[model samples]
Target: MTQPLLSERTLLEIAEHEGLVLKAYKDSVGVLTWGFGVTDVSGHKVGRYDTANGGSRSSIERAVEVFEWLLRTKYLPQVIAAFRGRALTEAQLTAALSFHWNTGAIGQADWVQSFLLGRRERAWSEFMNWSKPKEIISRRKAERALFFDGRWSGDGVVMIYDRVNPKEPRNPVWSTGREIDIKDEVRAALRKAGSAR
Candidate 1:
C-alpha cells in the first residue's frame, strides 16, 4: 500500500503545535527562525533580531504558505523516507514532523531509529530526553502522547521560554497527565487563521 500524505488535520495540528510567528527571531540556539520554526527557504536564511541583516517580517498568510511548503518539500520527505516500510497513523506522522521541526534531526534521532527497529517502548522513553525549557518538555510530552495515544491537550501550541522565566513551568500537569480535545483546538485555530483549507 502506498503511504498516505499528511492529512489536513495533521497539518493543522502541526501548525497549532508550532504556533504562528510573523516576525523572525533568534531561537533557543540563536538561529534565525520564523513561521513555525522555519530556518531557511529556497536559498535565503531567516533573520536574527540581533543582526543588522534580519529577514523581512512576514504576514500570517505568507508565513503559513512558507510553512506548508517547507513541510511538504523538506521535512515531510525526510520523515517519509525514515519510515519507508512502516505504516504510520496521521498523528504519528505529525508527531514525527513536530519533533523534526524542533530538532531537525528526527531522521537520525535514536527514537525514530528505535521505532523503526520495533522497539516502541524504547522510542517512547527517548522522547522525554528532548525535554527542556518546559515548553520542549511539554511538546515532547504531547508528541509522545500523539505517538503512543493519539491525544493531546493544554494549549494547542507549545509555549517556549522567554527571558523572564526560562525555568518556570506552565501547565505542569500536561507534561505528566493525559487529556483530550487538542484536535478540536487545532481545527479551531486553523479555521480562525483561515488556513484550514
Candidate 2:
C-alpha cells in the first residue's frame, strides 16, 4: 500500500503552530533552530556556526522548502512508524504528525496507546500530558482538537519572527510580528524547487 500524504491544510496547521523564521535562532531550550522549528538538517544539528557570515538567513521560499523537506523525509516517517501499520484518518494523521513533530515522543506517547486501544476520550486527555514548558499547552490543545474534533484552525497565516542572538536567551522569539498566509508562496516555491514528494 502506498503511504498517505499530508493535506495542505494539515501542513498549514503544523506550520502555523511552529511559526516561520527565515533565520537561525535558538529555541526555548536554547537548541539552534531554523526555518519552521527545525533543529537539524540532514543530521547536522543547527549551530552558531550556521549563523556566521549571515549564512543562517534564508528566504521565506527557502524556509518553506526546507520545512517541507524535513516533514517528508524525517517527521512523516517517524509518525508512520509509530502507528505500526494501523490505518488513520486524515485528521488523525495530521494530529499525529503535528504532535510527533513538536514533541518527538510519538513512539512512547501514552496517548497513542490510548488511541490504539479505542479509548479516544482518554487519548485526547492523555495528549495534554505532553504539555510542559507551559508555552506548549496551546499547541497540545490544538493538536488534540484536531485529532478528536477535526477542527483545524488558523487563517493559514503564520508569524515570521525576528532572529535573535543564539546566546541571548532561551525562547526569546522577537517577532517582526509579520504574518502572511504563505500557502500560495510555498506552493509556488515548491513548484519551482521541484516535486514536493
Candidate 3:
C-alpha cells in the first residue's frame, strides 16, 4: 500500500506538538510562562534574538515566524517539486507542506529535492527524522513523533517555530521571495507567521 502523506491541518498540529519554554515569561521561573519555542531547530533559549520575547517581537509570535521562514526559504521549493504538476490530493499536499514547514529540508535541501524527484517513503522518513535537537537524542525522538503524526491524516496540534534566537537566524529567512500559500500548501504554511498571521 502507498504510504500516507500529511495534510495541512496535520502539519499545523505537528508544528504545535513540541512545547518549549519561551523567555518572555521566564522571569517567574517557578511560576507559569507562556513563551516557548518549538523545542529544537536553534531557538531553544527564551530571551535570545530569535525566540521568546528576545528580538523585536514576542516568543509565541516568534515561533510562528520561524515556521513560516523555514517554509518560504528552505522547504517550499522542494515541496512543490515533490508533487510538481501532479494531482496530489489537497490533504497530501497540505500535510507534506506542513511537515516541510516545521521539520524543514535544511542544510540538506537535497533530500527534499530528491523526495520531490523520487516521491518515495524513505525520503518522507528522512524528512521526519530531520527534526532533531543538536545535543539531545530524546528531543529528536519527540520531534520525530510530531512529524510522523501527520504522516497519516489526524488532528495534531500545531505550534509556532519561532526564529527570534540569534542561534537560529534562518528560522524566518525566506530569500526565495515568493508568496506563501495557506488556502493551499504555501498559504497554509505561511499562516501565523509574522504579520501575515
Candidate 4:
C-alpha cells in the first residue's frame, strides 16, 4: 500500500497542540496590551488583555481564546481531515493553517486549500509574498526570505497577548519541519475523520 499523508491534526498534536496559552497575564479586555515574553503579536497567548478598547459587538477576549476559537469554529477540523488523505508534511499543513488562521481567512482561504489538495507547491510560493500589512507580525524581510527559499524559519506565528508584535508585523514562520512522506498518516486519518463527521 502507498504510505499515508500526515494529518494536520497529527501535525499539531505532534507539536503538542495545546492551542494558545498565555506567556504572561494580560490586561482585562483581551485586546492585547503592550507587553509580552519572547512571543510576538501573532504569537498566541492564554491570558486576558484589552482586545479592542471598545469597538463592535465582538467581545474583547484573550488572545488564546481567539486562537483556540479560530482553530475550532473556523473550520480547522475540515482542513485537518483533508490533510489526512493527502501527500503533505506536518510543517506544510501547519504553516498554511497557522498562516491563514493568523490572517482573517481561517475558513475562507480557498486558494490555500485548493493548492494543498492539488499538491501544487509552486502555486503556494507566492503566499508569503504579500504586503507587510497583510502579515500578522514581525521581521518582514527575514520572513519573506525564509518562506520563499523553503529552508529556515522562525517560531511560526505567535499570539502575543496584550502586546504588539515586534519587528513590524512581518510574516512569522520557520522552515516547514522535516518533510515527511505523509501518505500513511493521511490514509489512516481519512476514514476516521470522515466517519466522525
Candidate 5:
C-alpha cells in the first residue's frame, strides 16, 4: 500500500498556528526559535548568540523550506510510528501531526491509545490533556475538530510576528504587519517532500 501524505490544508493550518518568524527569537517560555516555531534543525540547537551573526531573519521561502524539511525528516516519522500499523484518515493524520509538532508527545499521548482502542469519545476528551501553557487551548480545539469532525479552520495566511529582544522575558511579538499565503508554497513543498520520501 502507498504511504499516505499530508494534505496542503494540514500544512497551512500548522503554519497559521505556529506563525512565521523569519528571525530567531525567544518563544513563549523562552526557547530560541525561528522559521515558524522551529527550535532546532538537525543537531544544531538554536542559540542566543546565533542571531547576531546574520541569523536574524529568514525569507518566507526559507521558512517553508525549513518547515517542509522538519516535517519530512523529523515529525512525519514520529506520527507514522505512533500510529503503529493502523490506517489513518487524512484528517486524523493532520490533527496528529499538528499536535505532535507542538507537543512532541504523540508516542505516549493517551489519546493515541484511546483512539487505537476505539474509544473515540474518550480520545477526544483525553486529547485536551496536553493543553498546558494554556495558550494552546484553541489550537487543541482546532486539532480535535479536525480529527473528529474533519473541520478545517483558519485562514490560509501565515502571520509574521515582530522580532523580540532575545534578552527580555517572553512577550507576544506583535505582527510585523506582514502575512503570506503559503497555500501554494506548502502544496508544492508537500509534493516534493512526498516524492523525496
Candidate 6:
C-alpha cells in the first residue's frame, strides 16, 4: 500500500507553531511576509508588498490555502527528494517538513546529509546547530525530539529532560495532555524501509 501524505494533525501542529498573521509585515530581513511566514508570493495574488507598510491584508482561509498549496507543491517534493528511498512515518515526514519550512532546502542541509549517510546520532545532534534565536532554538529542540523519540512538543516549548531533577515541571499542559507518541508507527516505517532495501 502507498503511504499517506502529511496528516491534518501534523498540518495543524505546524500552523499553530508557525502562528497566523492576517497582515503583511516585514520579516527580520525586511522581506514582505504574510500568512504563516510565507515570504514568496510570486504566483499567487494573495499578498502585495508596500515599501512603507509591508504586505497587504489577508484572510486566514486564504493563508491556509496558500500554506497547504506550498506544502504540497513545493516543500513536500523537496522533502521527498531529500529522503528519497527511505520510508517515513507521518510523524517523521512532518517533522522533516517543519524543518524544511523553517530552513530552506533540506537537500543542502548538513544535518540531512548526515542522516542520509546513516550517521543517525550525528544528524540528531546537528539539529541543535541550526539554533538561532530562543524561539528557533526551542523549535529545533522540539524537532530533534520528534525525529528521535517520536514525541511532538505541542506548546512550542522545549524542556530539558533531567534525570536528577525529574520532578521539575515544564509546561504542564503540554507535558501532560498535549504530547503525542508515535514510536510504534516510526518503527514500522523503519522496518518497511529496511525490508524494501
| Every model's TM-score | 0.70, 0.87, 0.38, 0.37, 0.87, 0.70
- lDDT tens digits, residue span 1-197, model 6: 24346555566556656665455555555555555577764234434622133434554446656766677667877888888758777777878888888887578878888888899999998878788766688778877888778887664221221111112221112223232333233234334333211
Task: Mark the 10 consecutive residues where model 3 has the least summed lDDT.
Answer: 27-36
Model 6 error, position 26 (Å): 0.6
Clash count in backbone of candidate 2: 0
Clashing pairs in 2: none
Error of 6 at 5 (Å): 1.6
- Scored by CA lDDT, what does every candidate get? 0.62, 0.76, 0.41, 0.36, 0.77, 0.60
Residue-level lDDT of model 2, residues 66-145, one tens digit each, is 66777767877888888888888888888898888888789999999998898988988899999998999988998899
Which residues of candidate 5, in runs, are more than 4 Å off? 41-50, 170-172, 175-177, 194-197
lDDT of 6: 0.60
Clashes of 5: 0
The alpha-carbon deviation from the true structure for residue 33 of candidate 4, after best TM-score superposition, in angstroms, is 8.8
Quote the lDDT for 53 in model 2.
34
Query: How do the residues 72-160 of candidate 5 rate in per-residue lDDT, one tens digit apiece?
Result: 66887889899896888877888898998998899999999999999999998999999988999999999999989998886789787
- The lDDT of model 2 is 0.76
Comparing 1 with 3 on TM-score, the higher-scoring candidate is 1
Global Cα RMSD, each model: 7.3, 2.7, 11.4, 11.6, 2.7, 11.9
What ranges in model 3 sit over 4 Å off? 1-11, 24-59, 69-74, 98-103, 106-197
lDDT tens readout by residue for model 1, 51-169: 23433455555665566666666787778888775778877888888888777787678888888888989988988877766767877888899888988443444333222111222
